[model samples]
Target: MTTRTSPATSGFGIEFLGLPGSGKSTLAGHFIASARQSGLALDTVRAAGRRAMRQRLRRSHARFRTLLTFAAGAAFLRSVYPVSKYEIGAYNRFCILHPELAHAALQAMSLHAADPARQDKAGKLWFKHCLRFQLIREEQGDANHVVAPEGFLQKALSLFGYGAEPTLGLETYLKLAPLPAALAVLRLDPTEAARRLTARPRQTPYPLSSMPPDQQFSTLARWAELQERVAADAASRGVTVIDVPSHRESSEGARILLEQIPEDALCSQGRDKRP
Candidate 1:
C-alpha cells in the first residue's frame, strides 16, 4: 500500500457523494479550493466511472468486463449523447436498446431490492468503477490527501448506478474496498435536485434523463433517502461520515463540512515527506 500523507496537517482522504444536481461537484470544487488555500496538499479526483472501470479491468485482466464497459461507453457516445455535452460528460452511461432497461435500472436502485439479476445491465459499470477507485487510493503514496466526488462511499451504497439488486452488497464491497479516512455527504432535497438536473444547460443520458420530469423527481428523492441510509450505516461502522446539507448555499455547506475535518486529520501523520 502506498503511504498517504498531507502537508496540511496529517494525511487524510475525503470524499463527497450525492445525487445529480445535488451540487456534489460544486461542493467538491469549493472544498478543493479551500483546502489548497490553507496550504493543504491533495489531489482533486473526478469519479469518472468508465475510466476507473477501464483501469481496474486492465489490472484484474477481466477481459470480458473490460470490453463491455468500453463498448457501452463508445456506443452511448457515438449514438446517443450530443457533442456539446461530451466536453463535460460527468455521468457514465450503459448502452441499452430498450427504454425498459433504463426503467429497470431505476427500479433496482431501491435500497432494499434484492441482488440484481442483470449485472450486465447495471452492475458491471458500477462494480468496475468502485474497484478502480479503491486501487487508486491504496496505491498512492501517503504524502498526499485525496478529494473526490461520488467515490467509495457512494459506490459501496450502490449509488454508482441503480440496480434492482446489487451485484456486490455493501458488506462485500467494504471487504473488497476498505473505507476511506472520512466522508462528507452533501444533502439536497430531491425536488430541488431534480430541478437542477432539468435546468442544467447540457443534455444527460439515462436514467435521469430517461424518465419524465415527475418520475425523475421520485428517483432523485429516493437517492436522497438512500444517501442518508448509507451515511448512517457508515457511521455505525466507525467511518467518519458527516452530513453537510447543501440544499441552501453551497459555499455555506462546504464551510460547514470543512469545520468537521480535523486539522491534524488532513495530514497523514507525515507518512511521506518528499517535497
Candidate 2:
C-alpha cells in the first residue's frame, strides 16, 4: 500500500501516559523539538493545563463558586448548546464505521437523558475544546502529529482519581476508545517523582505537585498501577507501547523511542504493527 503523506494530514496521534512528574513533558518537549526541527506536522496538548482546567471547571461544581474567576467568556456557560451544534453527523459516521462503540452508553450523548450519560456527554462535548479537538480533527483526516500528555488512555485515572473505584466503565472505555498508533508510558521511581513534584511546588497547574509528600507518593503508585493495566489492555490489541525511562545523562529518551518506532510509522494515520 502507498502510504499517504501530507503536512496537514496526520499519520497518527501519540499519547503519553504515566504518573505525575514521570518526565512525559520532558520526552514530549524533546519530541516536539526534533519533529519540528525536521519539519514534522505536530501539535502537543498538555495533560491538564489551563485549557483543561477551564473545561473541567465548567463541568464541575466550581462553575458557580468560581464562575467569575474561570468563566473567561462563553457567557458563563449560559450559551445553550443544542444537540445540533455538536458534530453529531461526523460522530454518527464514526459510529457507522465502529459499530462496537455505537452500542451501549457509547450511543449516549444527547442534549438530555435521564441519568449520568447525559452529563457525561455534555462534559465530553465541552472538553472537546482541547485534546478532544484532536479526535475530531483526526476523524476529518486532518494531518498533524498530535501528541497528548494524558488523554483517553488515562481518563480512568481522572474519573477515579477523586476516589471512586472504577468497575465495568474502565474496561469499556479502554476497549472502546480509539487506539493511537503509539502509546508511550513514562516510567519513573515514585520517590523520585515525589521529589520532583515537591521541588516544583509553585506550579499551580498540577495539584499533585503541591499535595503532601505522602499523598503524592500514594497517588503516584495508584496511577502507575492503573496505567499499567490500561497499557496492557492496549498492547493486547497490537498497539505499540513505548516504555520511556527517565532521561539519563547524555541520553535523550525521545531519540531512543523514535529509533524503536520509526517516525514514518507514527505519521501514517493507520493502525497495525509498527514497521
Candidate 3:
C-alpha cells in the first residue's frame, strides 16, 4: 500500500504505543534498523535502560547536583499549587528557562495531580510525571526525529485504562496534551493481544494481571477498543497516526511503519553535526 506522508517543519518526536504485548517495541527496533540500512538518518538512543541512568546518577558530583535540582523543582511545585492566574503564567513561561521540567510539571498539574489522591494513585501519577520529563526533554532537543518505544501516547493509554473513572481528566489531557510529530499505534484486536500477552514470558502488565484468564482477556479487549478510539481522536487533532498491523509479520509491519514517515523525517537527527 502507498502510505501518505507529512514532513514536520522542525525537530519532532515519533512514539510507538500499543497493547503491552502487541510487539510495539520489537516493531520499532525492526523499523529503525531498516531505515538505517536504507541510509535514512534515524536518531535513536543507544541505551535506554534504567541501569545506565542509575549509574550516571551514582557519581557523587552528579548525584548531588541532580538531587538539588529535584528538590528545588519539587519546592517550586508545592509553592504554586492551586495555581493563580499569575503563577500559572509564570509556570508556563518557565519553559523559557527550564523547558522540559516546566513542561512536565504543568502537564502533571493539568492531570490534577496537585489535588490529593490515595497512595496508589499518587504513585502512578508521579511515576508518569517523571517519564514525561524524559519524553519532553528528548523532543525539545535539536533532533530531526527521535523515536520512543513508548511515550506520552502510551502513557495516555495507561492513565485512561487504569483509572476507575474513564472521564478522569483523560479527555482533557487528550485535548490539551502536546502531540508528538508521529504516533504509531498497534492495530491488533484485543483477542490477539491477549493471546500474545498470555504466551509472553514477561509478567502481564495489566491491573487485571492477577485475575482469571477469562477476565484478563476481557479487560484487554476493552482496553484495545479504548486505544482505537483515542487514536482516532489524536488523528483529528493533526497527529500522524501510523496504524501498524502488529499481529502480522514483524518485518512486514515494520516496513509499512517506516514507509509512512515522510522522507524529511528520516533525516539523521543531530547525526550530521560536526563538533
TM-score result, candidate 3: 0.63
In angstroms, the error of model 2 at 88 is: 10
- Cα-based lDDT for every prediction: 0.54, 0.54, 0.57
Candidate 3: segments with Cα more than 4 A from true spot? 1-12, 41-144, 271-275
Q: How far does residue 147 in candidate 1 sit from its true spot (Å)?
A: 0.7
Ranking by TM-score: 3, 2, 1
lDDT of 1 by residue, 1-275 (tens): 22332111222277777877666777878877776666665565433333443454455455556567766766776587543132222122221222332343344454423534433435555534433443343344332366666565665444433544444244434333335567788777788777777787375435566678887777676667677766775566555677776745767776776678644346632544212
Please, what is the TM-score per model? 0.59, 0.60, 0.63
Encode model 3's per-residue lDDT on 1-275: one tens digit a residue.
12323231222356777887888778878887777777665545323323223333344235455666755654675587633233333334434544543344334434533334432553454344434334334333433455667655676666555444544555655654545667788877777777777787366763545557887776676678678877887677677778777745778877886777655455454453211
lDDT of 1 at 20: 77
Error of 1 at 166 (Å): 6.6
Which sequence of candidate numbers ranks them by lDDT, best first?
3, 2, 1
Candidate 2 lDDT, 1-275, residue by residue in tens: 22222111232367777776677767777876665555454565532223433544455444355656655444434465432222344355445654543342233333123446435744564344223343445443532256766555655555434333433355665566655667778776778867777777775223464467787688677777787788887677666788876745214777666666545445623533233
Cα lDDT, model 3, residue 251: 88
In model 3, pairs of residues that clash are none
